[model samples]
Target: MEVKKKLLDIVRDTVRFKHYSLSTERTYIHWIKHYIFFHNKKHPKEMGKEEIEEYLTSLAIKNKVASSTQNQAFSALLFLYKEVLGVDMSEWNIQALRAQERKRIPVVLTKDEVKLVIENLKGIYNLITMLMYGCGLRMNEVINLRVKDIDLGFDKVYVWDSKSLKDRVIPLPLKLKQRIAVQLEAVSELHAKDIKDGFGAVYLPYALEKKYKNAQFETKWQYLFPAANISTDPRTKIKRRHHILANTLGRNIKVAAQKANLNKRVTSHIFRHSYATHLLQAGIDLRSIQELLGHKSVETTMIYTHVISEMNKAKLISPLDF
Candidate 1:
């Protein structure tokens, strides 16, 4: 009989089987590696609850990781034991280190500030920034958009397999539609060029490539924001174009923020934050905004109410006036 494969191999297989994102697979594998190394490279099968507790404690006390990060590591380990190892850890009572109460608020930009930042950004970055802020889309959601996802006829963007594993249609900003149309034309030309060069293939998720034999060559499935050049797909070693790096897009936002003379910490996700807060200020219904943001619960969307309340000066009476 053939011997069983290694633990990480099994973890990869399990993650793929469950359709977990590539980022999740990397995170799970990273935490699992750290757990094994912390215990002198002993196999996790040799470890138990007490050992797991020790590792999580080390993360909080020694590593000084945030509460959310610590929780992620804990979840990774739990998944490893339960799913990969088939270990029954139902009685496991590992308590994670709790984060201190933080009264953190989302950083929002005034209309003028948003305009200034957009002015500072140029070309593709400008369009990307506009999409996120205008459509209230998260970074991953915008970057993962395909050519077919943008419905110019209906003036809506179709978001598939979003964070909540649900599909949503968000209104397209009329102002940006013309620029996006030009972008589509450019992409069409590029697709034609790629096909002439004998490499028009694009990737699909969840084994869709195997399901549809010639879908990869179809323009509809192409990435709306394709990379500058073709690169090898790490899993299959096939050379194809992928989407622009999200990190690069984020860095461009930071540079533009600085150029705009904004003092607050403006990130790519800040665009989404501002979107929700600004809509609340406009008196849009909370439930409607919740659906647009693709949030599973209205409670998540209600945080924008707090932001708008803080920004609204009408409710406040200053002691200095007295």
Candidate 2:
């Protein structure tokens, strides 16, 4: 038990040293622990590609996990072997029975539907949704926004260290400029209160806190959408204000969708999809949309073309209608 405990501790340290988010660190730890337990608590150094394959194949066949979930599990074990254990996984050539990946178009809300959903959402959630649809932000990207990321003078919104490290900038939506200013004022007031209470530090990414000793305590470094209360940081154990939970944003969006009486499935990502699709429909060039959406490849952005094509075809009159 002590050996397993120490192994996880080392994994956590490695993940932190690499500057991975807390959510990612937790996920990696969970999968690594599960892998060890699956093999009857055998240390990962004792196992190789064969044991890894057995565990992944079982996820597909026994647990019936999705391809992405299985892939995440695979990545965790790969990190454990290569990073933590100093083993060369390049030659492993894992051939596990892979879970099937589905090719489905993203569910996008219509412009009017977006307005309805926004109307149903209250306070910060409303502004967050607008930013997601306006800037094609992922849930994490918007929720993890820092005060320094928004530039009202330049009318820009900067997204940093997003999924796959795709950092990009977006034009600030003219409609939401006032709302953002109001939000900034609220954050400033809250930050002052926290400092008065002797707790004003915010979580800085990676080694930034070390480099800039006072950056974590600065108002610009604070979360743009902070949580209602200061809490203990799980990693550093520092009492600080953190950003709003992603699950809270997602849950509120779901509730707003239900209240809006929209039939199609709604998720935080739906707004991003809508943002991309609406840009395409507005005759925005594929390359420009790709850049705005911070897609690493044009091919990933091409999915919006299919969505628009399908939408157009759905508009065609059937024989009965004719």
lDDT at position 20, candidate 1: 85
In candidate 2, position 42 carries an lDDT of: 94
Candidate closest to the true structure, highest TM-score: 2
TM-score of each: 0.94, 0.96
What would the per-residue lDDT of candidate 1 be over residues 1-98, giving only the tens digit for each residue?
99979999999999988878889999999999999999999999899988988888888888888877888998899889999999999887776554
lDDT by residue (1-322, candidate 2, tens digit) is 4444588889999999999888889999999999999999998888998999999999999999999999999999989988899998888899999999987888888999999999999989999999889899999999989999999999999999878688899999999999999999999999999999999999988789999999999999999999998899888888889999999999999999999999989999999999999999999999999989888999999999999999999889989987
lDDT of each model, Cα atoms only?
A: 0.89, 0.93
Candidate 2, which ten residues in sequence have the lowest lDDT sum? Answer: 1-10
Highest lDDT against the true fold, candidate: 2
